[model samples]
Target: MCGTELTIEQSGIPEAIPVEFCYAGWQESLQLLALLTEPEIPDQA
Candidate 1:
């Protein structure tokens, strides 16, 4: 199993919110791995 944490801010809000996400099972693990390993493209502006 794998887990991730995130903090998000809402418009007009003074504080950030904490969020947690977890992935389990074989399929979910694969998906999580793909997301973590995906390549990022550079901006060519």
Candidate 2:
């Protein structure tokens, strides 16, 4: 009931896939948001 809205789309695949996902609580929702919004760090040689 309380969460953010997400839209997903995929292409170049042989079959259609399910795009919608619902989190059971705020903790799970926030965790997902953090993963998505956070930037990735590049590896150093």
Candidate 3:
């Protein structure tokens, strides 16, 4: 096995995956801020 330490943000973006892709439990409607769920908004005049 191979792994390295990271502070999440330093790791940048990861490939998108279904929220229900948890290793355990029924996560059909899961939300994690660390996963960068919020939509990007443009600056309004």
Candidate 4:
């Protein structure tokens, strides 16, 4: 079950999950990080 808000900018452009989301369960944290870094955006962009 996903219960985190992941705004584009809020995800550090696609490499970081919002710190708030990190407060959730351990699984949620991993999921959030995955979702946050899922975008194929270049690391240098």
Supply every candidate's count of residue pairs whose N, Cα or C atoms clash at under 3 angstroms. 0, 0, 0, 0
- What TM-score would candidate 2 get against the native? 0.41
Q: Please estimate how well model 3 matches the true structure, expressed as its whole-model Cα lDDT.
A: 0.42
TM-score (C-alpha) between model 4 and the true structure: 0.31
Q: Tell me the tens digit of each residue's lDDT in model 2 across 1-45.
A: 955686644455444533332223445877788899877999998
* Most accurate candidate by TM-score: 2
Q: Estimate each model's TM-score.
A: 0.34, 0.41, 0.20, 0.31
Candidate 4: misplaced stretches above 4 Å? 1-24, 40-45
Over 1-45, each residue of candidate 4 has an lDDT whose tens digit, in order, gives 855674443334334766655555556767778887776777885
Candidate 1 or 2, higher TM-score? 2
Which stretches of candidate 2 lie above 4 Å from their native place?
Answer: 1-24
> How far is 14's C-alpha from truth in model 2 (Å)?
43
lDDT values for all models: 0.54, 0.59, 0.42, 0.60
**Segments of candidate 1 deviating more than 4 angstroms:** 1-24, 42-45
Candidate with the larger lDDT of 3 and 4: 4
Model 1, C-alpha of 12: deviation from truth (Å):
52
| lDDT (10s digit) by residue, model 1, range 1-45 | 665555534344233532232223444766787788877889999
Q: For model 2, which pairs clash?
A: none
Candidate 1 local lDDT, residue 20: 30
Model 1 — TM-score against the truth?
0.34
Could you say which candidate leads in lDDT? 4
